[model samples]
Each structure stands twice: as C-alpha cells, then as structure tokens.
Target: MTGAADLLSRLVEEVNPSSAWRDSFIRIPRHRFIPDRIWVEDGDDLAVLDRVDDPDAWLRSCYADRPVVTQVDDGDTTGRGYRSSSASMPSIVAMMLDATDLAAGQRVLEIGTGTGWNAALLADRVGAGNVTSVEIDPAVAAQAEEALGGFGVHVVLGDGEKGYPPGAPYDRVLATAAVQHVPYPWVEQTRTGGRIVTPWGTSFHNGTLLRLRVGEDGTASGRFGGNAGFMWVRGQRTPHGTLDGRVRPDHEYAETSTDLHPYEPVGDFEATFAIGLRVPGMKDLVVFDGDVPGNPHYTVYLMDPGSGSWASWRIRPGPRDYRVRQHGPRRLFDELAGAYTWWQEAGRPAHSRFGVTVTCRGQRVWLDDPGNPVSPEDPV
Candidate 1:
C-alpha cells in the first residue's frame, strides 16, 4: 500500500468521484482516526493489529475500503466479543455523504462517533465548528476526541438516542450506527425541511439506508436508499435472551404443516425488507440439520421476544410442506405467512420503493407514498 491518501483517492474514484465529498476524503487521513491497538478479523477470529508493532499493516488496514473494528462489545470485552464501533467502509461513507446532500455551512449532528473519522469528514464538508457528534461509550469518545483534537469538532459522551439537545434544530442528523426505529428526539432536534439520514432496519435485517426529510410539524419522511450494514445504536441493541430462556416448558403447543416457506422472502433484498416491515420484532433463526448423519433438512425458528411466542419449522427435503409447531398467544408462522402474502400482493417493493415517516404518532414505514403505510405498524 502506498499510503492512506492514495488508498482514499482510489476509494473515492471507485464509489462516487463526482461527490462533493471528494475534497473531504482527501483532506482527512483515515489512519489518524484509527487507534493504536485495534482488532482485525483473522478468518473467523480476531487478532489485534498494533500500529507500533507493524506500521505498514496497520496503515494498510486503516486506509482500506473495508470497515476497521475499533471497539468491540461496547468496549467492554477486549479482543472480539461483538464489534461495537468501527470506521465504516470508505465507499459506504462516501455514499452516505452523497445521500445527505450536505451544504458548506449546514449544522450536522453525528450519532455513534466511533473513531471520529466520519465526523472529521463531515467537519471537512461543513466547517468543524458546525459539526457535533454523540458517542455512548466514554472510552470510545475519549479516543475519538484524541483523534479529532486538532479539528474543532464537539464530541458529546451520552446516549445517542436522546441526541445532543444543546445543539437542537440541526440542519442535518446522521447516525453512523443502525437504529431499529428513528428516535423522536432526532426528528425534533432537526430543523424543518432538514434531513436525517441513517441505517434503519430491524434485528433480522440492517441493510436499508433511510433518508428522511423533516416536515414543519416535527415529522420526518423520506425514501430508503442504498444498502448498508452498521452496528446497532447502543441503546437499541437487542437482548441476547434465548428461546429456551424466554419460553416455559409447560407452555401450550400446536402443530401443522405448510408448503409455504417464510424464508423464501428473506433470500431476496426487497422481499426481506418487506418482510421485516410487515413482521416487525420477529427474530428469524435458521438452523441447518447438517450436524446429523444423512439429514438434508433445516429448521426455522420464528421468535417474538415481546409476547414470548415461538414457532419451529422442521423443513424436510422433499416437495411436501414443512411441519410447524407453535406455542404462545400469537401464531408466529401465521404472522410470517400473512406478511409474505401482503408483500407479494404489494408487488414485493424494493428498499427504494419503501419510505419511512417518524412523528409523535410513531415511526411508520410506507410504500410508494407516505399516505400509504406499511400493513402492520412498525413494532416497538
């Protein structure tokens, strides 16, 4: 690798060179944002990459188009628990900046400051004084602050969900982390006619990018853009409770078989987004039976943490319907079937065809127009 600048130049050319963000990309050296002791994935495991030990490898990893893991497990566990913060891939960063449509002096508020690279880029686009960032982890915030010392950007250590109220009525609010639902505070803090861009999706899928425009009445509505995968906002991270932990042994049970495969929708991008919209809060777990000898089947577990409802589908290898067993107040499989049917009836709209509107009423996912809301309300 020649240098961080050369790599960034190549990245900008690859993603969107014509973007007004190119200057910021060149000016902000990504390596400056990366910490000394960072973790890099090694074939399914994580290995620490120390800049002092190997400057060449560290610099190459920092400037690469891929995301560099900075903090894992909310910075609680050291090595590789779950990646909590990262310097997002440069291509995605460029795409998001292009989508934000930022102007020179627009006041920008960034959620999940991670390594502060994105904040630096934003500051470069809109002056440093006009940018503010919120990061939940204090340690991570300190690192980002150090990285952004020379750049005059305000870093707030607090829950991003609440937003930095002191800097309310911002021209734009961009979240580096993924959120299941758009926080009302973000909508309220944004100025009327302003924009709020973030990675919005459920636990099952976090690929849809939403760009909402704030309305006069504190409501924000806009279309879902390109695909993106980001760590969940700290406050919105889902609990890791298992189905066995949540459901009781004495729970009533029911069974049936269906030719319908709910996972069929998940295989496609648009169908998956549509399914996630219709069946909100449902966790889709696919377990293969490959561990068993000569077993060519797989099982699908549809779990709803809110109601403690669960369904298990034992799919056999054949043209026959899969056997399903359900226990709890709600029929998990039936809900999936209903959602699949609804999505099919609606022409299986892609992420582009869908839009989200957030207000005091609630965050509503809509198709085509804001007036037409997605069938089932966005689950809390």
Candidate 2:
C-alpha cells in the first residue's frame, strides 16, 4: 500500500515546495481529503473510479501528482462530463502556495475550497483558526467542512467571487479556481500590503498564475507567471460545444487560403496566451483525420459562440498554405492572424512579461508595465 510518506517524497522530488510547507505535506495525508468516488477522463467523457471496487488504483491515484476530478456537471450524474471540481495538481498547488509568501499567525482567505486539502495546508502553515475558506457548492462544502472539522479552520458555504466580508482584512487571499477577472471584493477584503494569488486566463487560453499585491488606494496589480492552467470559476466558464454541434456542412462561409500555419498561433504556449488577450471570446480545437493515431492531417477549428463566428484552418503534412474558412459576423481567423503578427512585432514577449492591473473601473492587461496596456489601438 502506498503511504503518505511516499507521496510526500514524490512531491519533494517533483515540486520541491519550500521548507515552510514541507512539514504540512508530510503530516497531512492527501487521500483522506479525496472522495471515495473520483472521476477520471475516458476519452471525451469521465468515468467513475470507486475506492471500494479498486482500492489499490484509488490509493495510487490519490498519491499521483496530477489532479483528480472530484465532481462533474455540478454533481449531476445524468449531465455531460464537465469537470466541475478537482483536487488541483500537487505541483500547481505547491506553486500557488509558494507564490503566497505566507507566514505563521497571518489570516488567510481561501476561495474555491474544493476538497479542503489546500485549506488544510494553509491552516498548517498559519494557525488553523487564522484560515477561512469559502466554497460555493453545497455538497463540496459539506465534505470539506467534515474533513476540516478537527482542524479548526472556518469553512463558509457561499459564492467565492463576493468573498467573505466577515473575514475582511485578511493577510492573504488564495483562489484555487481560475478567473478571467480579479473580483474587486478580494482586493477590498485583503490588507493594503497583502497578496492575492489565483489562476487568470482568457477564452482562448486556460492560463497562468497571477500574484497581485493590494495597494492602499484599493486596487491590486501583478504579473502572470508559471504554466498553471486550472478549471475556470463556474460563473466565468466559456461556453462548451463540440465541433459537430458548432460547424456544419450547410453553413455558408467565405473561403480563403493563408501561408501562415497554426504552428505558433495555436500550438505555441506564449503565442496563444498573448493572442487570447488580444482576441476575446475565441476557442480553438484540433481534430485529426479519421481519428487515427500519428495522422499529420488535421483541422484546427476556431469558434466564437457568442457572435456565431467560426473559422476552420486545414493542415496537411506537406503544404505551407492552409485552406481557411470563416462564417458569421466576426473574422476569427483574421483576428487571430493579426494578434499573432502583433505579438511578433512586439518582440514576442513571454506570457510572464504580461501583467494585470485591477481598479474600480475593472481590469486591464498590460505589457511590460501597467501604463502600456495591451489593446487593439496600441501595437506594443
């Protein structure tokens, strides 16, 4: 049987979390917080993995570094397989915790409690009474509360976006879930010099870790770092659709050809991250010919469900020029190309070079510095 020490050793070798967090990882067993019934990806859908049925596999999964889906489609068995909640990858969890720069006795407010494993870690670092975690889903929250009952951590059942006002003036705020926008309430609740760490991404990108420092004037500013892609907060999730559902044979589309390939714009991490900031409401997917393995022939589909706009870029093994098709009000392919070109012209800065500033007006993504915003008007 795999024990907690085995998992801790693996985490230390893989993640190498700071000395402050190493003890917590050693003492707290991850499997205890995970549900007996977890979900694993089976092609396009998720299949249940029961601990009672297969104890060895379940225990192995618990100790694995990857995420384990805890809930799907908001706990509805009949619904489509949408990963609603999960125990975040241990590496990501370690990365986010390290970003916090937490200290003992400091009050921490955690968003999206999930399985409460992260909150338990926080409680261990700080005192248990100093940690307050908020969760939206009732079932998930109940389970977390039960798991944390002996830890003395306060688990609140409510919307994470609004934050817990009663626990205002927290030293740090951590959100396990990803968000397109940094909720202002988080800034309002954090102390002037406190930090807020969360995963931030756009429609075209899943995204990186954002660590913001609150200012006295009531705002937070930070840069994007680390390749941390997390499930979006339920309210901010982009619309989900399959290729067949969005694109059809009867639909009329303007056909064109481009020498530019999706190699960088779609395949490159930095390019896609920048393009996502420039081009909003666009999603991309690749489908291989005949669903065969090792097939170089594939089509990359870019769709904007909000405007009913879609683009299909065909890729073959040898051709430099690819066939492109566009339908609906917006030109998604052109926008993507322009954004990619813009990113290249701007020196092709890595995703980490980009930063965000959140004020009463809302959030603005900037390149290099906050004053130089990344907008259509400004090339840089």
Candidate 3:
C-alpha cells in the first residue's frame, strides 16, 4: 500500500486540483491531525479504529477523501448518536477553499478548528500568521493546536458563533460547521468586501452552502452554493424532545386536503428551503408505515420545538390526495403549501438562484436580487 504522502499527492491531483493550495496539500499531512481512536461507519453501527491495533487501516482512513468522525455526541455519548465534530471530507474542504477565493497575505478566520487540517491548509495557502481558527470544544482545540505545532495559526478555544474578535476585519471567514443563522458578529468582523464561505441551512434541510460577501453597510448577501452537509454548530444544535412531552398525542387537529403531494414538493430543495424561511424553528421527520424495507406509505411530521405546534401529512402509495392534519396556532402544512406555491410562481428557482442577506437585524433569503425577498407575494 502507498504511504500517507503518496495518497495525499494522488488526492490533490485527482480529487481536488487547486494550483493555489496544491502546495498546502503536499506539505500538510492529514494523518497527523487525525486522532488515534477515530470513528468509522460500520454497517448500522460506528466502530472505533485504534491506530495501535490497525495502523494500516487508520492510515488509509486518514488519507481517504471521506470525513473521519473525531467526536460523537459532544464526546459524551458513545455508539452512534450525533457527530459533534469531525475532520470534514477533503473534497468539500477543497470546494470551500475555492469558494473563499483566498489570496496571498490575506487574513482568514476559520469558524471550526476540527482536527486543524483546514486551518493548516489555510495557513499554507496564505501564511500561517494570516490564519485564525476558533473551536468551541477545548479538547478539540488542544488536539488541533498540537497538530498545528509552531504553524503560527492561532487556534482560539472559544465559541465559533462569536468568531475571533481580536482578529477582526478579516479578509474572509470560513465556517466549517453548519449554522441555522449567519452570525452577525462574523459580518461585523469582516471587511466591507470580505467573503464568508459557510454551510447555512435550517432544520427543514441541512444541505446548503452560502458564500456571502460582506457589504459596506455591515450586511452580507450571496448566492447558495451546491449541496454540502455538515453537523450543526454547538450552540445552534436542534434539541430532540419527545412529542408527548411537548404536545398531546391525541390533540384535536384541523383537517385539510390538498391536491399537492406533501412529500413530493416539500422534499424538494428549493421548495423546502423557501418553506423553512417562511416557517422558522421547525424540524421535519418522515415516518414510514412500518419497519419493512422500501415502504411507500409514509407520513411527514413537522414539529415546532418552540411553540409545540405540530403537523402531520399522510401519503398513500397510489395517486391519492394527501391528508394534512395540523394542530396549534401555526398551520404548518398550509404554510408549506403556500410557500411551495410561492416558489413555483417565482419560476421554480434552483437553490443557486436563491440568495440570503444577513445583518444585525436578521437574515432574509431572496431570489435573483437582495431587493426581491423569497416571500414577496405572501409575506410571513
């Protein structure tokens, strides 16, 4: 088998070919950043690979394009719960760097210092002195620091949400973790024409990337990049609460029938994103009929963690109108339908066509231009 250096060389050449950051890939060894005891997906379970036990396997995993799980459930719960932090996939990392449009001697602020691999790359691309990374977990930061060793990249053990204020007015801010909302502090800390390459999405969907450009007025607006999934930031993680604890299972619901198959439209990226903007603070779950494989009949449940409002839409296998049963103040299905119609009328724009603007006030998603908000016809 080829050594780490050979693998890294091939990875850069074949997977991610960036002339600017090619030297970074050649210089920095990814294996050094990865911990000995890492998690790898094994069938339906997560198996820990100890470097001492299987050096070759561990080295292969480190050099692979896939992400290696560093911490699970905030380093508390074992097995497979939630991946708190990870060494993100190399391809996506390369894509993010390309999105940043990094230039030499430009100061960069990295939101999450997971394994410090990306920070090392950033440091190599634009001098180590120009890179600053923030990690919420102290242990993760310590590990990253040790891996970075004398690299001169400042790894601050602080909340990524706040960003590194001491290193303010950065040329670019690259967030490794996904966030529900764009942190206003990031916008404030960036230069007028600075760019922010981060994964931004809602509870409805967790696969959208936003490459925002900071405006002169302390606001940032940019188009959505391709689909990129990452774990939510520590502070912005959604709480998983039982339905019985929040709302009554037998609660009376308002019945309504729609011609639209709730899943078909709601499952779409553009439609779901628009619906998420219209209906905030809601989590979605699609429950199939049984544990049987390849079940067609399923019910989509939309729950608002804040308000205890819930809605469920049942869909049959055949061509039948979906039944929507919603409870509480907010009619989720109705709102979703309206939002879907709104998206349709706007020419069914792709996720790339949509853009989001973040300011001290709040974030507003728009289509084509910032002047045109997504909810133009029906304002939420």
Candidate 4:
C-alpha cells in the first residue's frame, strides 16, 4: 500500500502546481475530508456508496482533484432524485486557490466548509489559527469542525450569507457556494483592500470565479476568472412555490427575439460567451438531449428565478423571429439577451474585465465593469 501520503503527492503532481501550492496540496490529505459513505450518481438521482464497496474508486476520487458529491440534500431525500449538494470538483478548487493567492499567516474565510479539505489546505498554509470556515448545515459544520479540530481552524454553523462577522476584516474570503449576488456580509467581513473570490453567476453550471477587492466604502469590484459550478447557498434558493403550469411538453409555443443583437448564427448554444451573458447567474444551466444539431427538433432552456421566468428556445432554421412563451416577473431570455448586448457593446471582454458587488441586501451577482448601481429597477 502506497498510503494516503503517497496518494496526496501523486495528486499534487497530476494536478500541476507551483512549488508553494504543490507543497500545500500534499500537506492536506483529501481522504480525511470525506466520509465513510458519500453521495454518487445513481441514474438520475444521487445515491450513497459505502466506501467499503469500492475503496479503490473512493481513493481515486478523493485524490483525483475532483470535488466528490458528499451528502445529497443532507442524506434525507432519496439519493435517486435531484442533487442538492456536493464536495465540488478538484480543478474548480484549484482555480479558487489560484485566485485566492493565500499566503502564510493570512486570515481567510471560507464560505462552504464542504468536507473541510479546502479548509485544511488553507490551514496548512495560513496556519489553522488564521483560517475560519462556515457551513450552513449544522451537521456538516459539526463534522468539519471535528475533522479539523486538531488544526484549530474555526468552522462555524450558520447561514453562509451572514458570514462570520466576528472574524471581522479578513484578508481573503473564499466562497465555494454559487451566489446569485455578492452578499453585503462578505464585503463587511472583509478588510478594506482585501480580496474576495467566489463562484459568481446566476445559474448553477454557468458561473465564473469572481475575484474582487473590497473598497473603503464596503463595495467590492473585480473581474471574472475561469468558469466553475457550485451548489446554490440555502438562503439563495428562490421560493419556487405555487407554480401555475409545468414545462409545456410540446414546447411549440416558445419563441426567440433579437431586437438588440445583430443576428449571427448560433453554435454550441451551451458554450457561447454570448449565451452565458444572456443566461447569467441562472441557478441551473444544462444541455438536454431531445434534438441534435441538423435535426428536425432542437431546443435548450434558459431559466431565471428572480423574475420567475423561463425561456425555451430551439433552432428550426425557419425564421429569425419566433414567438416566445413568457412566464413569471421577468421573461428570462429577454434578460439574457439584454445582458448579452450590454456585454457586446462593451467590446465583448472576458469575465476578468467584469467586476462584482455585494450589495447591502446580500445579493452576490456578477455585473459588467463600470458597474450598475442598485437602482429601483435593477438592484445589485
């Protein structure tokens, strides 16, 4: 047996890193951050696999730099349904660590404790006393606290939106949760000129790493990095209560309008920067299989919560304008296209050029640089 230490070393090399990050990677063992039984994809639902059943797979998964799904919906719901939680993918974690630029003795606040692996990594470099993490689930928080007890890293159980105010004025705040908007608490908790990096987006799968610096005025602004996916923080879940209708099975009534866009052929609907801009910060972004390109039927969905809207679009090669079926406070596609045009006129820069703001109401959304104020029409 090569042992866990050997595994850690192997991962550090495979994941590729500079000397300091490499050392920190090896110092923090991933297996300790996982439970004996964790969540797995069981067909459509997430199911638990007792580690004993596939110890090698578990070992590989933990070491592979991919975030493993730990407890789906906190183990209460059947693992076969929709997924609600995960340990997070490894490359994603690497992206965050890279963005954070954590150094020894720097005080860091991690929003989603997960299994505490990242926390351990931060503690390894910054010293346990310098790192404090928060997890919304008390059970998850308690588990993390116990796992990290020896390291002395403070893991608090509370709504991550609230942050750890007592920690007051952190040098860096790293959040694993995907935010619809940058919360005010993060700005308040971070020291002026401090860095705050998080998965900033409106959708679940289509979010980017937002790196910002808190201003003297308690506002944060920065650009987007590479893309990352994260679970929506508990409080951020928009109340989807009392829906009037289900997704129209036929999808025949859907439409698309580009009054603002200059009319260009769309390719890889899921990968376009324009599409991302249009559908920014959607809690869910996915590619479903009902039609392949060049087929008779092809469609994708861009859903938004804040406006209680969903847009179903498809490519039929008939005409540019199709009737759009709208629902909720905001017609989702309209917002996406509007945001897209806004990005286009600005020279179509990558996310890094954009900045983020944690408004007073605690919305953690990303916006274009030369930001829009929290006005009555469109607050942060």
lDDT of all predictions, in order shown? 0.83, 0.90, 0.84, 0.67
* Best model per TM-score: 2
Leading candidate by lDDT? 2
Give the TM-scores of the predictions, in the order they appear: 0.90, 0.96, 0.91, 0.80
List the candidate 2 regions with Cα displacement exceeding 4 Å.
376-380
Off by over 4 Å in 3: 43-45, 78-80, 242-248, 375-380
Q: Which candidate would rank higher by lDDT, 3 or 4?
A: 3
Task: For residues 33-81, write the lDDT of model 1, one tens digit per residue.
Answer: 8999888888756777889999989888887788998877776654336
Model 1 regions more than 4 Å off:
43-45, 52-54, 78-80, 242-252, 291-296, 375-380
Judge candidate 4 at residue 282 and give its lDDT: 50
Q: Model 2, poorest ten-residue lDDT window?
A: 371-380
Error at 103, model 4, angstroms = 2.2
Better of 1 and 2 by TM-score: 2
302 Cα displacement, candidate 2 (Å): 0.4
Q: Please state every model's RMSD to the true fold in angstroms.
A: 2.9, 2.3, 2.8, 4.4
- What does candidate 2's lDDT look like per residue over 1-380, in tens digits? 76767866786677777787888887778888999999987876678999999988888888888999999989876578889999999878988999999999999999999999999999988986999999999999999999887887999999999989998899999999999888889999999999999999989998999999999999899999999899888888888887888898888999999999888999899999999999998999888899875478999999998988899999997759899999999999999999999999999999999998888768889999988999633111
Clashing pairs in model 2, backbone N/Cα/C closer than 3 A: none
Q: Which whole-number lDDT from 0 to 100 does residue 226 have in model 1?
A: 88
Task: Give per-candidate clash totals.
Answer: 0, 0, 0, 25
